[model samples]
Target: MTPLLNYIVSHTKLPEVSIKNTVELLNEDCTIPFISRYRKERTGNLDEVQIGDIVKFKEQFETLEKRKAAILKALEEQDALTSELKQKIEATQDLTTLEDLYLPFKKSRKTKAETARQNGLEPLAKIIMSQNVNDVESVAYKYVKGEIKSVEDALEGARHIISEWINELTDIRNNIRQQLERFAMISTKVVKAKADDENAQKFRDYFEWEEALSRIPSHRLLAILRAESEGFIKVKIEIDDEKALTKIEDRIMRSNNDCTEQIQIAIQDAYKRLLLPSLSNEALQNAKTKADEAAISVFAKNLKQLLLGSPLGEKRVLAIDPGFRTGCKVVCLDAQGGLLYNETIYPHPPKSDTIGAMKKISSLTEAYQIEAIAIGNGTASRETEAVIRKIHFKNDIQVFVVSEAGASIYSASKIARDEFPNYDVTVRGSVSIGRRLQDPLAELVKIDAKSIGVGQYQHDVDQTKLKKELDVVVESCVNAVGVNLNTASTSLLSYVSGIGPKLAENIVAYRDENGAFTSRNEVKKVPRLGGKAFEQGAAFLRIKEAKNPLDDSAVHPESYAIVEKMAKDLGKHVTDLIGNKDQLQNIDLKKYCTETVGLPTLQDIINELEKPGLDIREQAKVFTFNQNIKTINDLREGQLLPGIVNNITNFGCFVDVGIKESGLIHVSNLSDSFVKDVNEHVSLHQQVIVKVLDVDVPRKRIQLKLHK
Candidate 1:
């Protein structure tokens, strides 16, 4: 435990005391959101990301420790566990180094080295490796036994054993790794049979590509690997063979003699047949792991942004799932996103019921008292939006074109089915569109993060890692913007601190079976919701019109006594102190500070007091696209048009410019200067104006430069 604590502290550069307290909290079954939010003073006010770093390092340490234990046990079983070896294995910090240290002791299958040892040539191999044997042939003649034909045969077998020894030498392997780290090149070539295949055309850029393995961008590397996986290309890692061999020989060779010459042969054979292949693969796997991390990081960031996207709040919304031939499916949702009505209207082409659609929309807006309209940006979305805009409704209603990216997935999901059991998929999809506008976090949590569609090679990256990262991001975002206890769905509640799927279900079930919770204390009455769960999740759950106003704020229930004390000191009621900025500013935070409740927690309490139950997310705004550009063919070079950044990657961002084909804002065209990060320039759902650089109608590609 101490070693693990020290490792996390060293790697994260966090204060040892803070890391120790955090680890204690984690071991006590505390979640990251709980430790970072509720126990700030204990963790030295570490933010979510910082606490996340601690968690990552802790998991890695546990993995390393587990591997070390297994290696020690394996060596013990083989009667090869030396004290020095055990100490070295236990001291290693990473899996790669530990595995390398354990390589020699690993049991092997039948190989040339094993065969030679079985044939009694290991002593001869060692004598030659010592480089002191002047007459190698005389030494080899002694080993001319069963299956040993001649002196050359004996020497060859000895060389084979020497090669295996060279492969096992830790220093030799590490030296080659250092060389490969600096000089390895990854190259890809089109498979001979797949050279002219139409499906291989997508990877034409990588058909004959070579780049420094260390310098390649993660997205590009993922693409190359994907192409290789699909049998479109052959990939290889290479380094200067002469330089690597020379370095190994420099480590092994001592003198110029017959024995030295024989050792040289073994060195070359070991490098080509064993070392290069094994180490090169290790190097590539390392690179791939790094690439996977990078890709997953981008996906997680994009998912966070998409999940925390600005909400339209509790407004009566009319949403449409646009289609041309099938007609647009429209649904009216009440303020809380309850489906009031659903029907289809065809306002374009075949059905062309423009006046009828407009009348129905106007009547629905007035009937449901709709404040906003959400249109899914799918087929015929623009045409439907145009028709809706033509109607002069009794009330002013803002219209939004929402990304239909995961709407279908959500509509067909079991959660959606349970929520709207009587409705078909189209009606459920329209409801999803409207609810997404009302609250992205609540709606998106029900759908899989990957299906949200903001990613770079999401399927190609590590699935477990991507899922873990995305879950963390979702949890962070959900906790960051607190959940409404009375209104939050099971999906939203599930992400709050200690409340997982089963607990979320229990909370919802308790809410339905009994009634909405009136205060924080009532939460404990829910079956199976114990002390720890309440401590971790109570603050993140908000209840409007609660008996205690603090129950609606971010303040934890445990801090109610402190607030009551503060109000008592101020000679006012707790309700009077709530949102009393003048009184809050006058209180000396130092006076309230205790061993457990320090300035950080006190300050947070004061901040929450100022804005009780206020959402951190921005209110959704209406955005409009260029009216002139309906398709890629209508776009012209140098025409500036409004766009929304739908997806962000390391290389660039994709912008939806009111067309079927989204435009590419390449990293170079993002700005006049070098763009290190695409997110620094743009984020998911950011509205920007872009100038069209090129539009390839046949290929359905649009290139745009950021107008800003």
Candidate 2:
């Protein structure tokens, strides 16, 4: 605990007491969302990201300690655990340094050095390393016996042992690592045999590329590595041999003698055959780790933005999964996104039943009482939207062009299958499109974040790290926008603080067996939802029109007594105090302050009372792309077109300009000045107008600049 305390405090530079309390809570199995939201006083108002950092460092510290224990045990078994060595091993903070300290003790397949040591050449190697033995052949002759053919063979064995010794020197390896960190260059060359392959052309930019390993952008490095992995290129890291060798020789060679010359040969062998190769891989791996983190950060950010995108809010929707040759698949959904009707309509090419499609859509809108029409932004989407908008409906129906990025994936997922066993993929896909417009967060959680198409080189990054980060983002967003206890699916409820998949399923099963939860306390009746689970998860679950009015709010059950006291002082009932801004503002917050509850908690309570159970996202808006532009062929330079930002990365954001090829708004084109973060200028699903800068029709590329 002390090691973890110091590690988190040093890494995060957070308040010591706050970090200490937060670590204690984390060790107690409190979720980040729970600690950040409900336990604010204990955590000193740390947000989810800060708490998440503490969790990351805590896990890292645990992993380091485990490795240290394993290494220490292995050393003790090998009879190599000296007091000084044990102290060094225990005191090292990072895995790389700890592994470096344990490198010589690692058991591996027998090597040339081990063979030489078995032949009893270590003593002779030590004699040569002293650099005072001018008569090296005389010393080498003494070791020439049993597996040693001559003095030359014995000398070669001694050099091998000396090279191994040089390789094992921790200072020498650390020095080489430092040099590689500063000056290593990563280079890639095209695999001539695969140069002209069609699939390899996507990576042609990296065929002949060279960059300083320390300075390359994460995206570029990922691209180069991906190209190498796909057999399109060969990647290598290098530094000047003379510079590395000179640094090593200066540390080892003391005098110019025959022994010094032999030591020099061993040094060369150590640098080329052992140290350089090993350290170069370490540097590359470290760079890869950095790249994976950067890429995963980008992915997590995009996923969060996409998950929390604007919700149209429980409107009956008529959704269409558009297509050209196969015709459009349409489904009518209720306010709760339950599919009521599904059918196919041909509105575009090959079928060209535009009039019939419009008539069917108008009738469906009237029959199903749809308040909004959700059109999938996929094949022939504009054509479908055009057909739907042409109709003169009885009521105003808002038209939303929903991004169908992962709808297909979700439609085919087991969750979707389980939810709709009687329905097929197309019907499930249309339902997803409608539900997404109704509530993006609710529908998006059903699909894997990586499949949702809001990432940069997501497939090329570290998959395990990517999954962990994206899951955290999902859980954070799900809890930030409290779930409805009555309506939330198992997938959505699973992300609630402390309510994992099993508990969520149990809660759902309990709800089904009995009825809708009537109050916060009723959650305890669910099997296995003990005191800790209820304490951690209850605040994030909202119940509408519950028996207790506070049950529908973010005000946790434990704070109900305090709110009741505030209401009592106001001479009003708790129900009357809620949403009464005039009365809420008049209450003196400090009057309710106690040792357990502080001003922060009181303020949050007051804020929640004002707008209890309110969503943190905005209402979804209708967007329109240029009617004049339907395809890339219609695009022209300087043509201003309405676009939606569908994906964002560090380098730039891609905009859907009502075309098959989404235009790339390079970071340089995002602003007149330098753009450090593309998200600062735009977000996922943001509508903006842009001017087309270039259109490569043949290559299916479109470049755009933000129009002021």
Candidate 3:
């Protein structure tokens, strides 16, 4: 095993793994999820993420091994395999070094050696290299056979053989490749398009430029390459030929002899035809792969920030899926997300009945005591907002423009239909939009996360890798904020530890028939929820208003007896010991410590006991966008505008300004001082007030200062 892989296993306290065993397991069809859950004993309970890292490293190791085997086989076939060559191949850690070692033995297209051999000048060429020639012309004249009819022809054939021998030296080829890759620059020139061609304007930015291969970012490289392929640009990789030739000559030239000139010509041919093209292509491909990885990494980071964005918290909300022709689909949801009512109202042109819509909204607000209004930021959303603003309610109800990026997709989803079989698609969409505002985690699971549109270049990334990564993000979010066992949908519950689709459905089914679980112990009574399942999942599940208050908290059932013992020692009931700061501080915590209760476990217990069933989510603060500012024209310099952060990148943060599009708050404008990363200043879904600093209406680029 490599030191890095061994270190990872040792530091993680995971199972002892041999290099061969890991490679074999990774080569099999077993998935990360399967191995993590079902084969826990084999992997020593390493989670999916750790196992995935192991699998990736294992694949890399195997690829390196395969490359070594290929090099050895090719060399053996050519009868050039020696103990030194075999040792070098076995010791090679990277593909580049292995290829360097195998360069001499690799088969190539028709070469000078075969040509010289066919011309019957092999004996003369051997005599030249043997350096026994007192007179070169006399030796060359001796091999003037049928193919070599003249002294010049015979010398040329001998020179070809000598050139081939010089090119076959592996060390010389390796040196040339290294120097070229380091000093190369790719140049691109755009071809002038036809006068009437529309593509001409699109490719104007990349008309001409030369850049180092290492310096070009992936997005720009891909864009420029695409333009070149479309006939608007010409691109080529160039290296300083004089410098390259000198480096090649320095390595191969030993002394002044007739063979020296032939070797020089051979090195140039090898470099131009074989080595340069191959190495340049490899470097370009490697650069592109690196760029893709960086972009995908950024996308994954953005996705994680978006997925972990704060939920609006549970509230009785009225959601409106705004539309002009089809009318606005409205749904009222109670605090627990149970659908209270549904209706449709048109408040725009063709059926512009504002009064009727206002009456319906007012009645629903009063009936449900709606605390907030979630307006879907889709077509006719502003008109719907105007209608709601005009309605006078008994209590203040704040309206919010919820991002309906995937609400329609979720409505058309099978899971949505399965959840609400009788409801129309529009009604389902409205409910989803409303529930997202109430609790994003519960509603987002029904729709594909990629459709949420919060990341950079999401669609361009590897689909399988993206899906797996996003699934993990979703899982982390769902678990971080504990699921509500009694009210959570099966989709939401499935993300909880040790609970999958079938198990979540069974739990929900058991709840439907047996009523709400009164205690954590009641879970085992449900069918298929065995001891192991409960052991893995029980700590994350919460039972609000259960018989024991500790059951409502994240404290595990096994630790319940520990808390009970502490309570008894303190001469108080468990409930009295919980949240009783003055009395709890007086008791010695060391008495409660056991072999299983380390400092980490003790701290967790103390935190749980201090705030039993404490919901970590803070109540979302109320804010509203200014109604007067509907367009860029309405925005003024230094005017503070309330908005939610839509996305964050390395360069800046994008804020939704309620103008159908978002504005960029460049990294420089994010704070009073320098900002290293956008995530450090703001996160997705964070509400902030920004001051508009500049606007370019033509480009639709609005710059804002987030310094306030």
Quote each prediction's TM-score.
Answer: 0.97, 0.98, 0.79
Residue runs of model 2 more than 4 Å from their true location after superposition: none
Which residue pairs in model 2 clash with each other?
none
List model 1 lDDT by residue over 556-666, tens digit each: 888999999999998999899888899899998888888799988999999989878888888898999998889888999989999999999998999999877899999
- Each candidate: what lDDT? 0.91, 0.92, 0.75
TM-score for predicted model 2 compared with the true structure: 0.98
User: Which candidate has the top score in TM-score?
Assistant: 2
Residues 539-596 of candidate 2 have per-residue lDDT tens digits of 9999999978899999988999999999899888999998999999999999998888
Predicted candidate 3 versus true structure: per-residue lDDT over 522-548, tens digit per residue? 999989988766865776788888889
> Of the pair 2 and 3, which is ahead by TM-score?
2
Model 3: lDDT to the true structure: 0.75
Ranked candidates, highest TM-score first: 2, 1, 3
Error of 1 at 699 (Å): 2.9
